[model samples]
Target: MNLSPALQQAIKEISSSQGISPEQFIVQTLTEKIGKLKQSNQTSVSQTGLKERDGILVFETESLNGIDFNELIAQSRQERDLEQMGL
Candidate 1:
């Protein structure tokens, strides 16, 4: 393929400095980046059931049944309001 003189000079310089052909250097760089990307994209599944749900899920720090849940619900509502406001 046709390459600019500056690019050709750069390839020669890199190849000589690294003791490898320009094509091999390029191939190695592409290979390494691809491997790293693939590794990073691999999401390891957790053995814990933190994400498992049978149906509609609700999250609450404490049940809203007695006086203990009053403050918890208030705090949760405040947090929800803050989230809605993009805080």
Candidate 2:
């Protein structure tokens, strides 16, 4: 990565003090930092959106499929027959 000599020295010092290799130290620290950054972004995004709702799918058919006009008139008159008979 062409790090500065002083920064490289400092990283070596820290790595030795922590009992870890320099490569391991860099990889572990960067992975943790990246994880925290991703979690922070996800939290903000989730807070902004509304809760979701469920949807229902429905299908329907007409009760009287395709009766003709004369058939409909006859049916209507037959329904009135009982009431008219009482009078």
Candidate 3:
């Protein structure tokens, strides 16, 4: 909560110019910042195709298109087995 001297001066000047107390100005600034952060978080979650289901985080499978996840997993397992066998 410790602000630099220049920041305090700037806040005092700006608050005075806006006819509000520095405390009120700080509160307003923090509220706006919090709002923006929440909005940004929501936007990022949606863009990343993430969702909360039964208190667990899951990805929206619609983003996977026509890729066969089961086949991919099988292929990965096969490759791992081959590598383990030095094949």
In terms of lDDT, which candidate is stronger, 1 or 3? 3
The worst-scoring run of ten residues by lDDT in candidate 1 lies at 43-52
TM-score of each: 0.39, 0.53, 0.67
- Per-residue lDDT of model 2, residues 48-72, tens digit only: 6533346532333356557698988
| Runs with alpha carbons beyond 4 Å of true place in candidate 3 | 53-55, 63-87
Regions more than 4 Å wrong, model 1: 1-8, 43-87
Kindly report which residue pairs in candidate 1 clash with one another: none
Candidate achieving higher TM-score, 1 or 3: 3
Off by over 4 Å in 2: 50-87
Better candidate number, 1 or 2, judged by TM-score: 2
lDDT of 3 by residue, 11-79 (tens): 999999999999999999999999999999889998898977899888886456789999999999999
**Which is superior by lDDT, 2 or 3?**
3
Ranking by TM-score: 3, 2, 1
